[model samples]
Target: MHPRLKAVSFAVATLLAGAASAQSATHIAVTDAPDAQSATADAPASTALSRVTVQGARVRELPISSGALGARTDLETPFSTRQVTAEDLDARQVKSLGKIFANDASVMSLGDTFSFNAYSINVRGIPLDDYNGYKINGLPFFMTTVELPVESFESVQLLKGSSGFMYGFGAPGGIINFVTKKPTDKTLFSADLGYRSDGVFSEHIDAGGRVGDDRRFGYRLNLTHEQGDTYNGANVQRNSGSLGLDARLTSALTWTADAIYQSRRVKGGVQDFFLDDFNGDTLPKAPSGRKNLGAAYDNTFFNSNVFFVSSGLRWQIDPNWSAKVDVSRSQDRRRYSGQWMGLLNGAGDYTVYLNKAQGAATYEQAQALVEGEFTAAGLRHQVTLGLAWQGLNKQTVPKSLYTPIGQENLYAPITPLSWNGSYDDSLQYHNYHSAQKAVFASDTVQFSEQWSALLGLRYSDYDQTSFNTAGTVTNQYHKTPVTPTVALMFRARPDTLLYASYVESLEQGSTVGQTYVNKDEVLAPLKSRQYEIGAKHEGRDWGATAALFEIDRGAEYANAQNVYVSNGQIRLRGAELNGYWNLPAGLRLTGSAAWTAGKYRETDAELVGHRLEGIPKWQGSIGASQKIPGVEGLSANAELHYYARFDADSANKYKLPGYSTVNLGVSYETQIAAHPVTLRAGVDNVFNRNYWGFLQSGYTFVGAPRTLGVNAKIEL
Candidate 1:
């Protein structure tokens, strides 16, 4: 066994032993009391102990939204999905999307918190589309360089496969949906104070309740502010606010509205390293992750703002029929002025370059759906019919200014040159527009008590246009496609489900980055197909799932000429296993493992069968939480993540070494003056391991350093 694994095992064993001994001592003291008076004196302690129960068991049963298909539990859904509730977010001290999915083997980080202002990930070895892969309450939103406030959401759901039939057009990678917090039946109010490593501090407030004599009006409000220096020698400030309102117009109809606004600013942001100019045969060793190689005079920063508004209505037409209609609009704006370093040789000598640009994307969507059940041909059928329309408008400056600045050495660095450039934001023009209209339907037929089949189809008309600053059309694309999905499910037992599904999707293509030779070029849309087989088992004290999946789609990459093009087909096959167990003696365990094999086909001879870049063949995580036997509301939790080595480039010439990281945390819950309070503290990357975290588009980023976080929450 590996030395690190052995050490971790020994530590867990020691902790369990100590907890058992403590519980034994408490039992002896209580039984050997001098008199009845002594037992009465310990009544408060007993009460506190009773209040502490197992945590995280309720997460598995949370209902998940399936777009127009309606809501369903994990066991009822034919696809693999996961939900992270607000409680899980607080307990894990999550600050970014990457942190929220740290323990998920099916998701891998493309950019960490410190590497970029916005977070990105690869699901099933494919990167999600920034414009189509993210949704808020089943509506589309642009997510490039935008990070929403986590406190404003009640839960986040992840669907792990193609969703063409569910949503009109999207990437085959997956979908991430953010569910907003709504007014509650009982009055709720809470305040939180938090501190992160390097002097970052935050304060947040949340409140929700109903109003009026009839209790027909409801409202939920959230406000947050955070500002401080970051681990990478950068200063960041953020402010955000959100409100949700609902009105019960009649006995069976409800109207809901939500609005959100956030502003994020950063100074002295981290610089990404570009290896396009490197002449060495092998990559250089990574430096200390905490080292600040950027210049003080660089004056690099990013200013981002996001605004969203949505309104919807839900009507119960009858006892077994329901209808919903929703419309939403959102805008994401960002201004970036930063430096990217270009490596010159193996010695790490590099030249700094500056870039300044501003851009914004506006998205509008409307959807209507109806769901009902009926009996047809001696079989019970559940049906859903929906229509959806969505459009996007992208605007940007005519050109981004790029210039070479100064030079520096990696091992022996010198001071940076002063900033000598400026940005012009006056002339912004529309660069791209896209629209989609679709009608979709699905039927689930139950042939017997234990057998069912689902058939779904969607027909869509998609239009895309790209224009130059002069309003001249540069590119245009139009297509009409029909996507379909079919699934068969069987109930092996009362609590076990086995299913097989086939799905097809139409995915939006990629846009060439500014660094590429052919900048501002938009590729044509691609078609993708997926096949999956899985089994799920739900028990009183445990839940488990296993799945095997394969995906095939058109591949695009930067060739030797530094031009981005689509010339081949990419195929990915993988297997995943996940489970959780609520063990005896206040111990809980969770684990997941994934193995993926990827290859390129029908491409250049030299690139045939080459492995995909930035994808690990094996990844997994294990976590354990143990409650203190004699102490009430106190628990210690630890998690370990492992990633196997994989190729860093399409040529398969360089390989990144495998690495592992560990995170540890503890929390205590108690009452102060009749109010409930909880305190938590945690440290990530406990060993301070230094390694490369991501490699994409010829840019490589280093992993984050060890960091600490402490938080306190009080309920009133």
Candidate 2:
């Protein structure tokens, strides 16, 4: 990845202002190889010019100032930021949120079929349990109830570290903020309608407009609908949308409000069974060597409802200073009513899987943030403050509908995948809980137009009091934590920057602080800390960056009921390199590679010196798009990703082999009927190789099998 001496010399000369700028030099860098940009551009044949981003920020000729203490939303930006631009998103033809997750290295999704195409994202192999709240448009509000429509977003931004200073009480690993596309001054609108390899169809809309003279006010709306079958036949369908309005409240004081709504009725399939549940519990007993129940296994189904509202306002406050505030409210509701034949019959205690779960769960949260920034003598500074509150409600009732007999019939036999029992709707259980409130703040300071530093802190106090529908307290717990972050950056050159940062994060145990019997003692909070250092160089034609990081996470154990504190501590150390290069003659390329080592410090982790459970030791990807020099309307793209082998459990008990997959795409677009149109087609897993990103049941969910997509669009 090192540049040749000539490339570096040209770069230095440009900085020294001693060289005749290279053609397209405004958009590219001399140090980048001619074809480097192809690695990042989408549809190499794209006739439109390309824009490359280093970290999360755009590699523009002019720098835009913000009130944020550095880049608050991108972990890669500070030193290890990663970005997936709108163009790449479109060319990849991603439809679900899980697919979009590929934009980053630290993320891996369980896919669309598990929770009715719902998702469980593993960041650095750590599950997201809402310790660090998710945000929308820089607000602590969450989209509690729905799937994301790719066409509705300008892009998704991920901020790693202690961001609580701005959003309040979140996981230390980092924060992910979904930046919805804002309405622009254009009166015309656009739409995309297509179907994927799976038996699913989708339609999305994007519309916006300017409000008055000078067009200071603007509004945008995004809507999406998709319904289809998974590789497994589980039914899937979702509807989600976003509406935003930005008013130039005097140019110096603007008000922006955006709302997001989503609803899904997805049927779940029997997901992976916990290793402990299979061994110790001895319930839901499957014969040994069983990796998965198989594609032929009947699926369990569940339905859920989700919704949220987010809004923000910006005030010039004064020419030298500006202030902004944002708020978001969200609700999540789930209804699990399914019949898993052997699930409830768990050879001995199948009740765990309970072929029948007539239960309902709902959780809601609210958060707000206020920020101010200033500019003086080439120096810029930004400060942000925030608060968060969250609550959870639950209810359960035994159903006789699936049980053949009445009351006692709740134990009736279940049809592996069908609900053929009677409904009782008699026996019932319910518990309600809530999270602690947190307040936080942080300062980001930039000096001499080249150096920047950020510091932030947050305090949280949580009180959980759960009760039975009978109005009796069933559990009570409390805890509090204080977290902080510090980061420093040195701009080696206008186009290059280097930085280092340290951050702390905490997560409340969902079942940790419960007031159970002597066997169910209260659980302690989980903690994590991260350190990272790296550098970046971005320009129009080429952009690249490299970084090293280490993260330490505290204990996760099972309760005294003889539990192992499922939350053991873990440590991760590694480095990643990624970037894009676009050169003359229509050649472009971009890619990333990483080597990681992780392990557990506690727990009877059988694999003492082994990598952390289920985490990969090495993983990386590279992609390229190219124009055939003289091919006016033709372009091609190729991408390859590799994941190294690693264990699946804490004991270093089982190993999941490493695998690699490749994707290729091509397209052609031009004026047809004077109405411009674009045509695209791509195949994932091009070789149609059968592989698994991780072990599932007896069979790993097949990596998206050789898949295909064709899209066409007309701009008005």
Candidate 3:
């Protein structure tokens, strides 16, 4: 065996032995019971007791439900899963979804977030944007071309691996599930006010309650508005609202619905430059991070209006069998206007253009599942059979003409151009349609109290078609694929699980970028695979997990003829360690580390062995939080994030320098005029370190500067 693999194996064995000896007093049951496999809200006492730590007690026992796995705790599952709860988000005053991964080493931000419209991320070394990469309550929710209302979600859950069998035709970067905040059984109301360093201000209101004597109907509503100068020197304004409702028609049936509206507009467009237009073997020198190079008259805007509705029917067929059916529909509409520029000469001359576009997509999904438990030949088995269908249709109108707006000098800038919103063929349209129908089944077999195995398979038929501006069919694709998953888990002790899994994913093939000659062309479906092994420990006061994984996926590159093709392969192998611990003196420590190697294994362009773009080989973070020794309602926390140097292009000729940043925060909880109030203040990028952020897609942007934020929440 390779030395690295040998070392990981030895460590796993040692940990298993140590856990067994240390926790022999307790026992855990690994039974193939129908109820045990069903998603539930009940949790062990030990798990509940652990939510008493320093940073608002991030819960460890939250049940996660996605794909065919149903609802289960992270420790009992055979995959790498992490979650950030509402309490954690509030305690840290998390600004956006991109910032949520600062403490998670396995995920990386790949684009500037000065505006929600440009945010993108990479999970386990696979890049994914809002589109084709996010879900709300296990159903498709726009994240690609539309912005999600983060305030409406109760928690953010990340499943890191190839989830094709669970979510058909998705990117191989893993799945991001947003669990909406459900209606409360009791009346609740809250309000919050906040301020940012750059003169930004915000307000939010949230309310939920049950109606009627029996409390069968529940409702929740949220509203928020924020506007100000952002850390990146962009003027941003955002407004959002959401409503959730659920009604119990009978003992076995429930109906739920959601309506959300969000819009973001930037008066001064943020910094985003492309390297393709520059003529140099190495990347050009970046201008001042604080300089505003955008034309004074240019602005970027993004707006989204989404409506979603779902219903569920649960029936108990027999003593050991149950069935469920779920159906949902979502429609999202978006509008965008923006531009990106690139320096063309040493004199600080650059090229800039303005464009406007509009898009709308509708997603419909349905699922049916049946689960049963039985014993045969002295072994226990839990079986699940499911069928699912998804349909998505989209229409878009893009700007047909690019009129260059002269750029200004870097050292001294002046407005060089203005626009009156006139364009050629601005209403030209394109239509797209995609559909997937799948049938899947899984069985978990328990041979003894300590051993269990899961086997699953999914068969799917996918269809896609596109229409040009003239309403003529331009492209069509159809494919039927089968994906399989297998895993085995062993309970080393009552609190420890050692597991290994193999999973495969299927995704839409490469789509040539706008910069390529055949920009609108699409390829066939691509198949990717992942192999992983890991260990998880869930204790009364602490939790930890470690894993080693490798992923191989299809990639695209420009050949010697300058034609883009999908005849390329990318591979990523890495190890991750993440966990949190609480000390006796009310201090809590959390840490995460990842080391990855990404390579272009094969390519038509002489790029074999070159490092993949925008992927840092080493990334990690560490945090500490503690309650003040003498202050009953005060706590202080700090964290540091680090990234290793990485390449910005496939050729590996240009690279980005490594950088690190630190953040500090403090919070106090007390009563204000008899109402419970919490005050929080924090500083991000404390040193105002200037560095290049993401460099994927041949575009580079500067990181955020040091910024201060203060917030206060009052319970009513």
Candidate 4:
């Protein structure tokens, strides 16, 4: 199969699967079970979501069902938030986390896995790690340095701008909050079978319902099995499962527990590939003169287990107010090892890097909190006060798997080999991990019938240690931060509203926040501040919003600029304008574009007037969904991503030119056995435009090529 066709296969499979699931559920036992898999809320009882698995509390709440900016995907809404609903994900057949954000302008991918390093996501032009600490039902899923499968999440929420108050510390750019699917309170079953152009085949079974006939006890289970080659042809496979249970002890009390386990066999990037560009070129191409991606590892890593348990109760103290309390604990354990291979120097011979390295990590978290909501002065107010704690541990051992260029023996590019056969290699690493703790409180106050105000603050303390197996050990460091934020919302009319906010967030300098030579030189946690105002209006089938926002950031690490001062404080100030018009002539159009003026304000560095590195000065996208009368279940849609000129490096010294690209997909889906069956095909880079999104050591994570696929899904 052609490389591009493999990607196209996945795309087609996704759209068809979605159309099937949406149409087939009506007659199945699906709708019969309420609170079972967030059934279509279109039932018309109350325009509220049926349930929410939030902060250890599993309660059916209607607060978020309102609209996009306020509830739905409001483009002009301050804060700029977006959600990939479970329903849409089903139709799209999105497998990797990166795939979900492919078309989104607000989220940028840092590209491939180096040592299985996950693709980096920049929210508001800042690394995502600075926002919410990666969490899963209150546990640290990110503890293991492995590529976590994105399927574990039913929906992914990317919130742009300031939300630091909710998580204590975060980036001014925003945060990515993934809401995992929970056990259904009612009864349900979902099975999915799929195949993509990448030679990947998969099977999944997700089932849930009341544990017994009483309906007070319920449990859910998910299982996935898959194997195939990715865009680079490295064979890929994984087996994973998760179990969940929720029980209602009394009208006001509840308890829920969940666990996930998986063992994966993967070909760590024999050769990770990249495209020269992603933002500017609608057409795509492999950067010039690059070896096709390959997986040369003779080793394997099993990303093993993650589990959590918790109990909570919502007590209606009185008609005017209510109190809720919940506590949960979770743990993540993983072990992996692999030999790393390197590209050949100017000569044609291949190179061997690390012979073999074995690594393991355990991440744990605990949370206990009390929250309250009440009606006051013809308005409503909600607040949460709590204490949160997190811990992490990591260790690794060295084993000789391959001979280096200077070694006596040479490593070959043939099949995977136990190159370490009989070689005596010492365990050379013994670094214990780090820990973090924080106490925070946030409140939403309705100041008047037409407006509300929000205020929040959090204080945190963190510490870490790193050591090699040798007799020597490194000292540890600590960080403490106090952050505060405020915002206001005013109702312009029943169909229109305006919001303005000044929100602040902080990130403890840790991941890349440390400098070994100078303890004082260690970065202060990065600071992010934002100001935003936007309006929302809607009537009949039409809705629109326009927002203007600005954000500032303090840089922490070098994106690899040759200069030291390159890590100085940087700022991104811009306005994001977006909207969608659903007209009467069978046409629905939507797109958003933004402009940013940025620079490094620190020392006398070589960079000034240059836009921030790796960021496009202007980026926006437009897509359309059309209705056709002649073709049954057929729809054609296209979207374009445009990025203006940008600086390739910090010191205005080097710059990479900007580019643009367009993507088109058409689908024809119809119901089968009550489940929708769909066929889709499209060309990603319509003209095969050649460009580079950014350059680092001349390596690029290539944009996907043209691909096609077909998929079927059934629901009951």
RMSD after CA superposition, every candidate: 9.3, 8.7, 5.4, 10.4
Tens digits of lDDT, candidate 3, 574-693: 877777666667787777778888888867548888887888899888777788889888888888889998887777766777889898888888998898887778887787787777
TM-score of 4: 0.76
What is the Cα-based lDDT of residue 315 in candidate 1?
A: 88
Tell me the tens digit of each residue's lDDT in model 4 across 338-379.
Answer: 333333331223343433334556555665555567777766
Give the least accurate 10-residue stretch of model 1, judged by summed lDDT.
Answer: 39-48
Best by TM-score: 1
TM-score of 2: 0.77
lDDT of 1 at 225: 90
Deviation from native of the Cα of residue 326 in model 2, angstroms: 2.4
lDDT (10s digit) by residue, model 2, range 382-487: 7767666656555554222333111111123333333344545556666555565777777778876677887877787877666656868876767777777787
Candidate 2 Cα lDDT to native:
0.52
The number of the candidate with the highest lDDT is 1
lDDT of each: 0.75, 0.52, 0.69, 0.50
* TM-score for each of the candidates: 0.91, 0.77, 0.90, 0.76
